[model samples]
Target: MTLIDPRNRYPRPPFKTQPQDFPGLSANMGPEPDYGLDSYQSGERLKGLVALITGGDSGIGRAVAIAYAKEGADIALAYLDAEEKDAQNIASSIEAIGRRCLLLPGDIRKKTVCVDWIDETVKKLGGIDILVNNAAFQHPRKDLLDIEDEEWRCHFDTNIHGMFYLTKAALPHLKPGASIINTSSVNTRTPMSILIPYSMTKAAIANFTVSLAGSLVEKGIRVNSVLPGPIWTPFIATGMPAEQHESFGSQAPMGRPGQPAELAGAYVYLADPNNTYTTGALLPVHGGMPQL
Candidate 1:
């Protein structure tokens, strides 16, 4: 599960710069941003593929869905009913790319709903080729004791339990060369101070992705995870406490947060057939977090 190899190494950037000087100057005279949004363009990597993305309504999920559509995949978006406006915007964007987009509103926390989602997607889209389990909910807590039983259960149901349900439901429809990409967070690698329960769910995703990759590889399904560091998304703005939200991803070596567009390439790479040999991997999209 560990991809970091100490024996093989790469150059480390100087760490003594001020926060304002972050993102750093490139080898050329120009300065580079923390994450390269301009460089994260897509080819027709997923042409003819059909992808289902939970949380496809907004944030990184929205970016991935749009990127996949631009790459030539028809999309099925599953999101909570509360995200109607955002979901509609994503669907419109997808359609603008000349790809078909189906928006399904439901609570993924229920097993029945998960099953229904896959069944409906297959019926609407013909078959499922890529499954992206990316919906999650996290509430910041001052202490573990401050977390209510309902909140803990909600985290488990939305983050881990729903992922299990949807993956199981979609398995029969997914064929060889299909990919299942889960969204685990950097919290799994470096646990956050105030996100105890949420961090636990993310860690579970990392373990589950590895376990599922092993179990499904014989069937030729590729399973992997993307552990994002601190991306600036509506999830942070709305999901976390208003006060703590300001400092969301500032502590990373990159100093500033990432944009949604920066994450699109990683998803495109993993979903593409070119990455056939890679599976059971946790690709860190964190801003140069030191690997242990």
Candidate 2:
């Protein structure tokens, strides 16, 4: 196999300061995030499986959905209604690959929405073998004093509560050999002071993954998390403060932000049924950023 240099493989940061409303669209991003549309190679690692991914219309979720579809898995994407255009783009690509793609548009913060999406996936896709809790919400504040109760609750509702609701609703459909992958972050270890609420939710996700893994092991279900570092996603372009954009990922030891495509393989690995022994792992793909 050929190797690509990690540092210079994708676009480096010093990015343009382009901000958008909450839940930004990747298509609007300058130097749009590479979701492996033309790059990732597929080996059918997840063939004959159905996977549901929240936030699957863009960023890391988009990359993972594309990768999984390429690998022969039917995909179900759960994203916000505002991201219709982005969701449609992904659905078209998956359909072109001859795999089924289900677009579920709703706010995952609501338990009803979560349950509906899970039920829809099972009804349409037959069954779900992989569950990816990747949708998240984060708004940075310069100081904790500036953070409001609603802002803090928004982070928890979307990031942590949504995961819980979706996972609980999916539990019935997730049989033996099913894989549950949550999108945690390097913030779990090194909480960013400015993103207190977001960081706290991430830490909770890490603990949730481990505890849930243990709880599901008896049923032959496996749970794990992918803790990504400074990835070049719409989240960076919109969720962060404008002043931070230019040096968005400069703090990483590699001197660059990681592309969403770069994290696809980690998700695939954890979901691959062949790796039965691995569970409750918090795999970090942070461009050599020190999480400790």
Candidate 3:
């Protein structure tokens, strides 16, 4: 078995395909993304806590959910029907770790789904202490004019709007020590032309994290956002045309695509209840990708 080194530069060979080729299934990606089953260990830092993770079917979301389970937290996973296969596997893995996994499958674009997911989480897992707003939609376009009005609007609905809906619904159940982690991106600082809509939402997420952190301080709720660089996920495999996949992470300073497992640490650290003083922080897991 080849031991994967987190520090080495990774080269993703060229691949070309039609857009949205893989949809939500990471398992079917040419080089299956690692969800960190072998690389991570349990510290039980989140014992007795309950979390609701959006897009928990695969990639970083899956990694975070599994890590949280290892830390002794029960999970409520939100995902799309297209991701059901991977979602089921994630659920089973969480259960195998001796924690309950509640699978809530639906589009976050719908306000009702967001509300219902939180309600179901509280009902099943007792209460939510961690809310990971990790679900997002990104479609790369070569030109600004190529983006359609409907697609642009959908990005906001799925990315930022859903976060708002869920956070509002979860507030009542959240205690003073709860932590909310939103998935921002390196593009928040350096916008990529291909991902204009996605970048816009991420910047908004970072802004929301800071603004919300200040507002929630009185309630002792901490809010933060994570900025991920080029990490190998289903997004790289299928979001854009196949030709773009060859050098996906080559642009990062580290010259490699980070595995989903790399971001797991930041997610857990930000959610650490004992680390109470940390809030409104933008934790970057970007393989040395310069923020500026």
Best by TM-score: 2
104-206 per-residue lDDT for model 2 (tens digits) = 9999999999999999999998989999999999999989999999988999999999999999999999899999999999999999888999999999999
Maximum-lDDT candidate: 2
Give a tens-digit lDDT track for model 3, residues 71-186: 98999999989888899898988888889999999989999999999999999889999999999888889999999999899899999999999999999999999999999999
Backbone Cα, N, C clashes tallied per candidate? 0, 0, 3
Candidate 2: minimum summed lDDT over ten consecutive residues — where?
6-15
The best-first sequence of candidates by TM-score reads: 2, 3, 1
TM-score of each: 0.86, 0.98, 0.95
Tally clashes: model 1. 0
Query: All models: lDDT?
Result: 0.80, 0.93, 0.88
lDDT of 3 at 45: 98
State each model's C-alpha RMSD to the native: 8.2, 0.9, 2.3
TM-score of the candidate numbered 1?
A: 0.86
User: Which ranges of candidate 2 are over 4 A from the true structure?
Assistant: none
Worst 10 residues of 1 by lDDT: 21-30
